[model samples]
Target: MNVFEVTLQPASLKNIVIIGCSGAIGKALVEALISRFPDASIYGFSRTASFHSLEKKPDKYQEARIDYEDEASIAKCAALAAETGPLDLVIVATGILHQGEITPEKSLRDLSAEKMMALYQANCITPSLLAKHFIPELNKGSTSVFAALSARVGSISDNALGGWYAYRASKSALNMVIKNAGIETARRNKSAIIVGLHPGTVDSDLSKPFQANVPAGKLFRPLDSANYLLQTLLQLTPNQTGKCFAWDGQEIAP
Candidate 1:
């Protein structure tokens, strides 16, 4: 079935949590969720405590502060969110591509142990940690999703030209984490779906420096990507758990 044809039943999505609610895609996802699931209680967690800087403030949802680098902060935020009752969906929208002096490596000579570790921390460990703490809170007998923002470059089988050593390796590791988590979650909550999502070349700070090379119709705005992703997500079933999917709903090979 075409993903776009899938309609989410609002009654099934009663509570939601977004881990990186301050990011461009995260903010757009929040807005889309609010519009689509008006009665759902949406909770947002970001590094920033205030929503004053967001282009669209989350006036209808609750917000909290969190730090992906800190395990304590993540645990506290997850616990607070759990208090609202069983979570129907949890999306980890946090990821880093380039920071300050650290950029994608062009060759082995450009790779550094420090930079590689930093990339793994952001792209791999953070989402794994989120699953570690949040998966148990998902509804036991109902359908639930624990999704992390991954990338197309993370697919080893799809890598025709390899240059982004650190970013690629980190996302690959993230894909593995999602797959492993999905297997375990299924054993407990048969309806829980854990997967990685590639948002395509979105128009965000993460893709800003790389957009020049993106094809004309490839670079999607945050709202469009968010809408597409949510549609893809709504169509997923338990049998499709542990897979990585692009925004268009195509499965990506690990």
Candidate 2:
């Protein structure tokens, strides 16, 4: 679909939703968005949001529960958020690198079906399910965005010293999901931008284990990455949908 065919509406952040909001990047996005769009109706979803907290939340900001494994719950949460109005922004800031003792495989021999499935479930299935339910909630006339966190290693062409097989593969598949979702969403809402964002090596729990390998000065705090990503999203045009971009706004090679 040609984006030029439709008159682009101004970027809207009136209604916002943050999936996996309990995580570091997710939480930072919540704060950044709140500061940037004070009047926006922000919704946060996590698997562990307390019921009492949700009940006490103000009308402008609410928290709910969303289990990546449970499609029904994801649907319910999306429905609840849309009750007020269609969502202008939805960010799935969830991804899995390691859980407890489980870490990314360092070699081909280290691969296991169990480990691979778990990685796929977190890095791929969760975001795909979110897009499945949330894409429909995107504003049609305005320039809305459905962005999920992706990694740079996901680029098959960029893989040189490959080791993390499942992690890389899961993100690659997630990128494809973003692409397909972008095409379909563009057909309905040409002004909507569906893309994936690589938030860089953050100081979050997800990257804590691998921090040693990161170059000094390259590691970023969660809020720093959040600001960069937010800025990147703000600069995106409808024609650039379906691609993955780094925190600096540079598109990752396909």
Candidate 3:
């Protein structure tokens, strides 16, 4: 069949719902989605009350409160978003590196159960909860993509220099959750693509401290990373589900 003959079904189109919409990448994604798919609805979910202030918010776009730690809240948000229409895309951009209470440990001695568990709750358990609750929102007409922002350091095979053990372990757990979701979703929604994406070091509060150590051409602004990641996500086929990929389109080793 010729390219014109190829059918891109409604399920293949992206009507996106973004979690953690108040974050740097989340804000950029809202703008990028609007610019790229002018007609697509972009629903944003965050715990904060300021989600409506995003640039060029679509008429169809709406915002709601979501607490990732609460499974019931996630289900409710998903149900509400699905009620609006069939969702073609779901992106989870929520993550934390170093917060006031949970700082990244530089040494083994600094590691504590409390800090590690907190990181895991924020990075892994929450995303898993999102996957568990939000799967119903995806359109089954064509290929739909569900993606979560993961970290490269989460790759167990790629670890050469290691320090942030808790952060790394938490993200690694998230990677597994995404992979497992992909497998299960494949059996049910054969056309859906569930993936884990590493967005690299972008200009955000999460990466602010690490920016000083990044090399000349490596760092990216939140908008740039979001744009690149969107393009990558759009290009994903059903066959690529359950895979982890870097921002540059490189497959990350598990």
Candidate order by decreasing lDDT = 1, 2, 3
The true-versus-predicted C-alpha distance at residue 184 of model 2, in Å, is 1.3
lDDT of 3 at 206: 94
Which stretches of candidate 2 lie above 4 Å from their native place?
1-11, 50-59
Q: What TM-score do all the candidates reach, one by one?
A: 0.93, 0.93, 0.93
Residue range 1-254, candidate 1, lDDT tens digits: 53223333457898899889888989889988988987788899988765525456555588988887888888888888888688988999998999998899999999999999999999999898889999989877478889999998999999999999999999999999999999998888877888899999999998899899998899999999999999999888877889999999999998
Q: Where is model 3 poorest over a 10-residue stretch in terms of lDDT?
A: 1-10
lDDT digits (tens) for residues 1-254 of candidate 3: 33212333433455778999899999888777777777777789998877646545568778889977778899999988788677788999998899888788889998999999889988998888888878767877676778899999999999999899999999999989888888898788777788899998998899998899999978998889998888778666777788888887787899
Model 2 superposed RMSD (Cα): 2.9
What C-alpha lDDT values do all the predictions have?
Answer: 0.88, 0.87, 0.83
Q: For model 1, how many clashes?
A: 0
Off by more than 4 A, model 3:
1-14
The alpha-carbon root-mean-square deviation between model 3 and the true structure, to one decimal in Å, is 2.7
Q: Record all residue pairs in model 2 with backbone atoms less than 3 Å apart, i.e. clashing.
A: none
Of models 1 and 2, which has the larger TM-score?
1
- How well does candidate 3 match the true structure in TM-score terms? 0.93
